[model samples]
Target chain A: MSEAVEIPSGTLTVTRPIGVQFSWRKAIPWLLTGPLLLFMLAFYAVPVVAMLLRSVNDPTWTLAHFHALASDTVFFKVFSNTLYTAFTVTIGALLFGYPLALALVRTPRWAPVILIMILLPFWTSVLVRSYAWMVLMGRHGLINEALLALGTIERPFRILNTPLATQIAMIHILLPYMVLPIANALRQIDPSLPRASSGLGATPWGTFRQITLPLSMSGVAAGMLLVFVLALGFYITPAMLGGPREITLSMLIDLQVDQLNWAYAATLSAVLLATTLAIIGVFYRLPGVSNAFRMGAR
Target chain B: MRRFPSSKHFSRRTAMGLIGAGLAAPYVRPSYAQGAWPEQTSIPDILKGSGELRIATFGGTMQETQVKAYFEPFEKISGIKVRYFPGTSAPKVKAMVETGNVEWDVAQLSRGSIMNLQKQGEYFEKIDYSLIDDGVGKEFRFEYGIEMLVWAQVLAYRTDAFKGAVPKGWADFWDTAKFPGDRALLGTTGGGWPELEFALMAAGVPADKIYPIDIDKAFASYDKIKKSVVKWWDTGAIPIQLLTDREVSMTSVWNGRMAALQAAGVPADISWGQGLSKRDAWGIPKGAKNAANAMKFVAYSTMAIPQARVAWGIPYGSVNIKSNEFIPEARQAVLPSAPAIKSQLVNYDYDWWIENREAVIGRFNKWLLG
Candidate 1:
């Protein structure tokens, strides 16, 4: 209220107090974010910090869990496998999602319909969706049954409980996470830039390549980051859809926790958390990704 | 009828424990034929109490079966109120005891889990054998807990899979050329112990001498069918689902789950030969509020009539040796405890697993992914 003191008429330069204006501007954001910041600190940050501490502190202050991970071939295999799956799923999601997002933005008349189509599956529980994938991709599932009816194959194809199944289901589940951001960015683009480029006698493909694609790179970066980080921690999908050897770090953490090997489980969790942070760091280091994150925050 | 896959097993262990006083639960009529009510054994005076005895059960169908078998009747006959919670396991008990806020008077856990936790610290109250029924076998009794129910992990195959040949044992399950279809086995995905016993038997190791398991020989056996095995199932439902889908023509499944599937006309039959019997036990957490009532209820639940009631409602076998007489022979034939089937099953050594599980799992995971 003090900062809102009105200036005298026709004297626009008559001075509000500079200190009050600066203090209010600085304090508003903090005041607005206070509760959420406290909640995240209490529920998320503290537990995560405690969990990271458990990696070395539990039972005794020891580095055996990390030491074991150094030579653990299964750990290495699973870690690499996790990264491979995340990368594949991100690329897959981008391939499917970017086109859908483009279609969503380009077709204004059908925007709501396309949005609902994307949002419907997004709103469904991941478990239900994963199970739906199981029913679709199982040996005797709908796809195989249809394929058999069409005489496309002599025998039922194995699809479920494989890496292929894991990627497919993860992409399906994460498509919206990729699509919505890209669509938002695409919507934010001024329509005249492409129009002006085309007006200059530039070909449509040339205009799109030179004008539109570069503008949407931020959205693409944002979408890929979201999908990849989410994919890194996926548990139920791979467990339900991937093969026995498709063990991810999340599953390994779960396994160790069940065995009451809290220290090892904490170590695995810390590694996963660290890897996610590293990926985020890498994304930020990429050109335009930091801007994408800033635009995403808006 | 479904069991926990390994990832779910942890949450399943940290089960909710709540006490309800004088709460009336809906009566689920026993699915099996009923014997005389006011069960032949009388409730002792000490067993009749007006207070609540909270029990931690693995809810869903198991809870429903237990309610029909003992919880409802025990509440009615004894003046003691029976309050049932779901999803109890050894870890929950340990958590409760360590925190000094033991919520459950009693919990249902595996003998191995109870012993594993007991070895870590004093989490359970020592079993009072004098209050227990004589029908419970000597083998089922332990210092801290008593095994109350028995189920088996056995080979289950589609009746239509092999045309006329029956896959009688693990050897037949491993003989994919003869069986001629995909197979599923228990994997170490969900903190579930791998079925090393099955692998040993598949390698022609006698059921009697299967443990101290020859891990190398077992893996060698697993190698023969690794390519043919389509799924390494973690939960009880997966194998049944696989069989129903004909995705895998043969799989290792829990006997009770297979029974449910067969009842649903899935055409899957369990081969009890060389199966492994796993037990669920009742453990009273140390410093439980109603420890005395829990003891009395434990004793009451294992009596021949109550034990038979449980077997009648669900396909799980009763630990009470006399329970077989009360259950019809037809029902007994489907249970793991039946003499014909029991003779073939190798009793699982919980002690052996408790000692060697971590090392074995590390080796198993390395081998599996390799």
Candidate 2:
């Protein structure tokens, strides 16, 4: 109360420096993010840094561990195989997810139930879901038995432990990740835009093609990024549903850990992390991806 | 000012000193993980309050049997509270031994797993032979651990798949023309021994002379059936699933899984010929607070009475040879360690695996992808 003084004459007073405003502004974001930043630093960042350092520092400063990962043909194949699976799963997710997302937004009556159905598996453990997939895809499983009894085929179809089964199971697991985002983006689109286009004598297909599809591209990109990045680290589904040829980087990492080659395991993990980061970097560098996020912010 | 040598280090030193008196652990790291030994309460004083025993074991029907046959009795006799953690114990053993904060008093480790960890450092307490009887198999008794039981990696087939000819051995398993259907094989275990041994047997090497495996010939033999093999199962349960589902006509399955399948009325038949049989052991972690009680539990659990109970419940061959009289011969026919089957079954060379594992696994992993 005492500080509230009236200016006696035409004098002006500045109590704080200009930098204080900027500093206080900066502090708001930092304060908001402080817990997350500290958590990431301690749990994720520190362990990752240690793991990367260990790739070179294990057993008296040797690069042999990295060299082993880089030089081995098996590691290379598994690395490439991981990328292939991720790509396949992403495409498959997008193909199924795009229309499901469209239907989810369009169906006024069943949206809640559909959303719950899509999100249901999240509550179930991934291992349990993978096992369920195994039962459904196995030779004596429902599909094969039904087909055989119908006399559609002479022998049981080969589905279990195949690449196709891996892809199918992965798409089932990741469909919600793709669908929810696209549906949210689609819902955010102005309702009048498509109506306005149709009112201007544009055909239904034309209106959708011109107005709705372009607006949903951002959602598509988001869903793709989410599914593809998640798929790269997948192991249980692939291990359960795919053959030896389905060996990927994650499985290779597990094998190394079990082998008691902790140093080598760290090296493989670093390689996998770097590969994921590089993929994300390239994904960001692609045209329209950043634009999609900026557009979605509206 | 400094709280240097940890209590765990002190305990290890006490253990080492006691080794001459037949109280040392099976293995002790020359240097404590945290370094140095600090004076602490004597072992007895440490256990004065906590009579709790924590055992890490796998969950399934077998674990159920263990709870009824071993844990319940041990807790009853020793007046110790027992808690069970269900999972594979190797990785946990590794983590606890490295961090020096051991939670598990006892764990059931596979022969290959125990041997592999032993090579890295001394992790298990040395066995107190005075407490254990000589009835436990010599092959399974380790300096740090005692026999748990034995299981096999055996060739199993669907009876309906072949009407006339049955897959008798590894050679028949290799012949695609005679029994043409999808076949399943295991991918590399930590040691590539099973595949290498079987491949040698398939290539006409006698089971007795299969050791010192010619890696070249084994790979060549593996290459012959590579196209015919449809699934490379990663887990022991997968092959059993494969057989029961009829996904594959023939598969290499764990004897227990096969037994379970057969008992459940699946038309699955397991062949003992050229099969690989392995023993599992019960080991105490080095820094476990209740190591003495854990040892008592292990010794009692491996006795004929307990072993017989386990075999009767789960149908695995008991480690205690004396349990043989208790397990009926009819039931013994299905166990890998049965006297009738033991002569034909090949004992997996655990030492060779311990030394040659990394190199062999590297090659096998490459071949698997190829």
Clashes of each: 1, 4
DockQ metric for all predictions: 0.36, 0.27
User: What is candidate 1's CA lDDT for residue B208?
Assistant: 84
Off by over 4 Å in 1: A1-28, A287-298, B1-41
lDDT of 1 by residue, B138-204 (tens): 9999999999999998889999989989998988998888889988888776657888888888889
| Among all candidates shown, the one with the greatest TM-score | 1
For every candidate, the chain B TM-score is 0.90, 0.84
Candidate that would win on DockQ = 1
Q: Which pairs clash in model 2?
A: B25-B125, B25-B126, B26-B125, B26-B126
lDDT of each: 0.81, 0.74
lDDT of 2 at B80: 77
- Across A71-181, the per-residue lDDT of candidate 1 in tens digits comes to 889999999999999999999999999989999989999999999999898777665576678789998899999999999999998999889999998998889889987
In candidate 1 the C-alpha lDDT for residue B189 amounts to 69
**Model 2: per-residue Cα lDDT at residue B123:** 82
